[model samples]
Target chain A: MHPAISVIFFTVTSGAGFGLMTMIGLGFPMHNGIVAAFLSYLLGGGLAVAGLLSSTFHLGHPERAWRALSQWRSSWLSREGVIAIITLLLFAVYALIWMFTGQRIAPLGWAVAAGSLLTVYATSMIYAQLKTVPNWHSKLTPFCYLAFSIASGLLLAGMIGKATLILGLPTPTIIVIALGIAWIIKSVWWRRADTIGFSQTGSNTGTATGLGHLGKVRLLEKPHSGENYLTHEMVHQIGRKHALKLRAIAYILGGIIPVIMCTFALFITPVFFLLIAAISMIIGLFAERWLFFAEAKHAVSLYY
Target chain B: MTLLPAQTNKKLGLVIDLDVCVGCHACVVNCKEWNTGGYGAPLGDVDAYGDNPSGAWLNRIHTFEVTPDDAPAQIVHFPKSCLHCEDAPCVTVCPTGASYKRSEDGIVLVDESMCIGCSLCAWACPYGAREMDPVENVMKKCTLCVDRIYNDNIPEIDRTPACVRTCPANARHFGDFADPNSNVSTMTRERGGYDLMPEMGTKPVNQYLPPRKKSRPEETTEIAPAFVPKAGEGLLGWLDRALEKLG
Candidate 1:
């Protein structure tokens, strides 16, 4: 996997947006202009749209993107697109009521929140459903996505809610818990990724050639004298040292830093500190998302 | 719509004999030549005829050296392409329904017009069957020569896939596997043909015939007569002339 920057940004930023929507919508009673104008519209909606648009950059035919939504009955990618549009529409309606009427429609707000969460789940399933790439095909994948979404969303809300809402030990405690849970889930995911791979599907060269009965199978020569689409795309062999270094960066920046910052916030209670925690966490998650794609081994690589 | 049919009327597929394969890339070249003009035409290439050349190809041949415990090392020539699986994840995962398996012939195909070329189908396929045309930015794979097989203009004998027709060693066989009496079916039964990656449960229509067991050396072996040195030739005499040439 090349881990295209467009896709990485799309996943992390859009996930944060949907997570923000879920939190703000769920807590609609705090219907200040800050929550409605800044949190919902500026932060959540802007990131979501920008991320969605960013995803199209890597497409071969961005013009044909509309056709993707038609296959919702089967494709997770299609489902994600549809859910995202619907969630965004719902948020638009909820935003209007909040801004104009100066009142919160509790039901509409909750619906937007649920739809946003579902959109994020659909995004998670885009990778989770791929059995060919066993690393992403697990229950932990969605759990990781959901946890990260909420954690990022909470920090976003925490960054803005100082004037309107109470800032104390409780919010930092919640962030610490979310950070702990997210990293724990990510660790378990890495552990399980090793156990399940292309070998589990019996797609080795011996089985590939159907010559295991004859002897051990090894590549005498590659099919092409030079690289082709399959070799270049599927056979991405990241060095162990680079992957380990990236993993450490993700854990330290994404997981440990946030926890430390939140713990520090317990005594200081500074908005600037929470803002820095949010930025650090996003950077950490950016690293994590990059590793997610870089480390994934496609079963097709077995043939190459 | 992605739900697979209970049964395809004809499981049209290829049976490759590993024993007969000489590791020549005739099938690979023939497929590229025919498909470049037949359908998915122009099989686009970038940096072609340059320092590096890369392009989309429907079929490829892989050569492997295998060494069994207590046995001699054997060279296996394996040709691979789309299996057109009964449970093709590529088709199911295509968001635009561009990737499809025919209910009539069991041949999986891609509709380039409808394809957004997200490469999701290629990701779902375990065989490395699909390739993206960088120029066209669309996914491509073996179509089982749909146009040639059904065409009325071509001669009946030549109405098979270009790969099957061009195999110099006659290793590639094409027919309907659904018909028990078909050549492909009978050959599979007699030769113990097996599916590739059965653990994935895609239920590939194509089957590979494993290499035949080698026969042991006879106990009573004929000995060759010893060579006699030429009357005028000697080791010192040969070195004298050869050394002069080297100088």
Candidate 2:
């Protein structure tokens, strides 16, 4: 729950990367020619790899991160790592084939698209599977992650389309709609998150300590005088006012502004508007991802 | 390997009595001392002698004030560590095969060699049982003294968890809960032992017996009368008389 910058960058950037790859694999402006196709792959692959590398910077043992892919049978994180690798490999092959041969193999492209989307799903499950943080342990979490990934990915694709003169008239509408849907999903997620923990029945301190029968159980003394890993990692206390302000910033920058920018780009000075839309969306997502970790209440905090 | 065993032969865990625990922190200290040298990595400290000292500790004693609606408030010294649940979310959540629960004894442990120190397993644990070692950057939790309990080098009587062995108030008990006749199981049944956060569905092997109610001051009988001096009762009375005569 620390809202680590490395993790936030990893999720936001990688989600966008995978999302972009999915769009490219599905032939979203990638059929425009060699330069456009190559540029699309480069941007998508760069973002994906950069995000992946950023994730490793937070690891205590980055060299041993390979071991994480072994337990895909149970662990969601393992599944995410394994799927991400497979997706990257497939995306590379698909992009190379398109760039060199200028021929889009239908089956291979579909496989790349599927792989990219599945990677995003696996990434979402990394947080959604955690019952300890009730805010994330919901069906809506995956929905929220996928929506954001797709929307951000579309924004990037729209930018590429405008620059390449391959901008389909309906593409802007689609991107705007995607952005709106992403915000709607996030709004629902925030609504549920606002009432997820402690307030929920059977998820409070009394239930956690098994002392409801005795009435109120209050912490008299903490286990340690100083901050331990648990307090440091799990006990993030974000004020409601600060959180509201961030949410507003996220909505205005990530949601409303992008929608307005995408709509304007459909007619007037298209390239600049699309680029601004994409950049604003990423910044907005960073804020959103930060709140995703900060607002979460781990069940272990009940003891403290 | 992170997958839990379908059934464990022995559910080895602890039973802490809140009534008996005096919050001495002896168990907490002994656990740290023994674990630092006995198993995996030495429990490391950061800024230990400096301002904002923090460290990884396997066991900790939390003091809580319980206020019942019908009774006065009372303090309970709660010593918490790994519960080693039958359905351990921590083990399953481990991306590497680093975290696992033994089928033989049901004690959950981390294989530090394989740990990436992602700290996901710690997040999975609802009891705040796991701690990340600052130096080794690996996950650490109570091993239930797996090194001591089976060590032929140590005396049989001392073959228990360091915390249970060092508890001065006799509040901590360790044994296989799978056996119905075991001391822990019997104590649990007789004393109304219960799990922490049963709704979490962890089905923890460890249990805690609630503190017994305290007797109110008015309910206690006053037996001894106020002191009154008798003339020839004893040396004290004679001295008092002699002093009076002199006066």
Candidate 3:
């Protein structure tokens, strides 16, 4: 799947945004609960909008994205678009109601939080439904997306904590714990994906020739003169050694470093550790997201 | 208008006999000939005589040789194309309503005009059935010759798919899968047909019957004809025989 940079950014940014919003909406009443609650809405709302806007750049016709929301009944992509927009609307309404009434609207916030989570589920299902691509079809993929979002969201919340002195000790602790748990889930997901063998032969040169008898097949002949659409779209040749190095970098920088920094910050200066953790997570997740796309093998590659 | 009653028609499909296929490629040529001139748009080919030659082909034949244990080698000819699966992943993944499965006949089709050329449907297909039409920049696949199958101008007997009509071996058969009494369904039931990559669970409408096996004859040794000695050779042999008797 020639992991387009635009899509990579879209998933990570939007995933983090949605993840953060759901967590904040759920944990609104923790410390300086009112102010923390408001901040959560603001930060989560802003990031979600930013992610959606960035995703539009990938579309050839951004105007057509509007029509995408109409087919939620059948299409997961359409459902995702619809769910995302609805999440935003619900969050806004929840915020407005809270601001005007001063007292918390528990039912409304809970409903909006549920909607935000559904948006994430829909986003994950878009990839999971594709049975041809073994890598994306796993049940773990959606869970991984959900976990990564929450972890990224927690890291974001911790960063927010540093800027403003809200609920002192317990707040940062909770965020760090969430980040740690997310890190573990991602690690397990990576390991599981490694164990499963690809169902389809990555190259289709032999399959096309109808010689399944041949145990091993190499590129015996070039199918065409110049690059065809199949070759360009499917046979993305990212070096194996380079991918291994990138995975290490993603794990250390995106996973380990943030966890350590966040954990350390809980005891030491909350602001210092929080800032480092937040920055590390943002950078790490971007690398992780890039690898997620780069490493994924589309079944169409069999043709090449 | 609720003028006509909702008639439940079973989706028709093809069950190719791989064992019987002769790899003649009659189906491929016939399909190209039928599709190019019949449909909404011609299956365009760029640079037919120039350096690079490429065009849309609905059916392709691939020949393979399989060697079984304690048996002579077997040649299997497979005709490759869309299986038209019941649970088509291609339809679900399309962001636009462009790709859809018809409830009336269960044929998975792409609305070329509505397609945004995202290539998601192509990625979703396991069989590599969907090909991007570079000219139109939209996905293309076997429409089962929909435009020709029901044409009133064509005779009822001749209205079958071009590929089915052209197959000299009669390896290809097409009929409504809903009717168990149909020729294709009965043949499949009797022969115990199988779908390609059943593990994927696409529930492909097209089934492939295993190639029939042939028995081998027993091996035997060959013997040379009896020989007779010439006059000179016989005399030399007699002298040698006398010498041997004397010794």
* Candidate with best TM-score: 2
- In candidate 3, which residue pairs clash? A204-A302
- lDDT preference between candidates 2 and 3, better one: 2
Q: Worst lDDT window (10 residues) for model 2 chain B? A: B220-229
Chain B TM-score, structure 1? 0.87
The window of 10 residues in a row where model 1 chain B has the poorest summed lDDT is B219-228
What DockQ do the predictions score, one after another? Answer: 0.58, 0.70, 0.16
Model 2 ranges off by over 4 Å:
A162-169, A199-201, A238-241, B217-247
Instruction: Find the candidate with the highest lDDT and give its number.
Output: 2
lDDT per residue, candidate 3, B44-152, as tens digits? 6666687776655567665555565566666667787788788777777777787777777767777766666667677777776777765655677788777767889
Question: After TM-score superposition, what is the CA distance of residue B2 in candidate 1 from its true location, in Å?
Answer: 3.8
Q: Is the docking of candidate 1 incorrect, acceptable, medium or high quality?
A: medium
Compute the lDDT of residue A192 as modeled in candidate 3: 67
For candidate 2, write residues B174-216 as lDDT tens digits.
9989999999999999999999888787899999998876766
Top-scoring candidate (DockQ): 2
Q: List the TM values for chain B, per candidate.
A: 0.87, 0.88, 0.82
Lowest summed lDDT across 10 adjacent residues in model 1 chain A is found at A160-169
